[model samples]
Target: MTSGSGVWITLEGGDGSGKTTQSDLLADWLTEAGRTVVRTREPGGSEVGQLIRDIVLHHRGDIAPRAEALLYAADRAHHVATVVRPALARGEVVLQDRYLDSSVAYQGAGRVLDGDEIRNLSLWAAEGALPDLTVLLDLDPESARVRLDAADKPFDRLEAEKTEFHARVRDSYLALAEAEPERFLVLDASASPEAIAAQIRDRVATLVG
Candidate 1:
């Protein structure tokens, strides 16, 4: 919202929480409204991010927790500079899959690091830029696991984590939303996709115009 007529919206939730489905639906709706929408995701949004993503998500080994956090921060710095900021300046609606909130939940809370430290690192990495609106699709880890199992895709590092880890991540996400209710729209991801998307659209409508 600060750069131009552009509005930056990020989606957050556990894996398999219907973020992609909702993003697709929301992007289609925004496109119908004659808005240029940029659909991207953290850890793979840019070329550099893709490589880092592979390392962090797929590499076979343990990356020190701090190192993992720094990798995400690096990706954030590049992504915001190369992808997010320019698009905002061009007045495009940026629909992102994840952002610093993921780092806070996954890296900080899940990894048992200081949530504030992870958040500060991300803010520093992105040069203090934050999304205008963040939509949090809340779902239980067990439900999320069922959805992921139904997908039959290989799990990423975080997705492969235990249910308890994911529960912590969910708690962190909820806490983040509670702390900044004005910037976040928290929804029950267990709802029908159509219902969830409608809610997202209603909130997004306020930001678009």
Candidate 2:
């Protein structure tokens, strides 16, 4: 259960882990349950964040790992202040896709940077805000690749990285969940979307009840 009046739930996973689909399902279910749901995503939730998202995800060039980490932190700082905090202040359930965890997993572990530094930077940027519940959709790199390929869409900067990079990201996510079991609900991403969503709903119900 959330300590605050508003419940903040984050959905985290590697690329093609079905986070977007599951987020949609959870949002719809919460809405049907008569909750005020504010569904959003990092690096694109606010107008300022959209520009940062493009630079970090779609830009064609070599970005220094540290620069990339800072860019994400910039987006996160603005996003939480303008979007997430306000929603939570209004007592609305904020269902977010990705958050500081993504930065820790991608930039820290995948990019081989200092994980603690990356996490500290993100936490400082977000003013120490942390999600009440983090639902991690765990999947293998190969299965994630298959799902990404099935989408028939071009890969983004992170998605285009080598298999080893994604594997590292997954390892980091699992490690984070293990370190914070009470705050995390780690689910198998290979499961059907309905099943995944059902499990998420059950956990969220406890928070919003």
Best by lDDT: 1
Index of the highest-TM-score prediction: 1
After superposition on all C-alphas, the RMSD of every candidate to the true structure, in Å, is 0.7, 1.4
lDDT of candidate 2 at residue 158, scale 0 to 100: 96
Mind sharing the TM-score for model 1? 0.99
Model 2 steric clash pairs? none
Write candidate 1's Cα lDDT for 1-209 as tens digits: 36488999999999999999999999999999999999999999999999999999999999999999999999999999999999999999999999999999999999999999999999999999999999999999999999999999899899999999999999999999999999999999999999999999999999896
lDDT of 2 by residue, 31-59 (tens): 99899999889989999999999999999
Clash count (model 1, backbone only): 0
Q: What are the lDDT scores of the predictions, listed in order?
A: 0.96, 0.94
Report lDDT (Cα) of residue 143, candidate 1.
97
RMSD (CA, Å), candidate 1 to true, equals 0.7
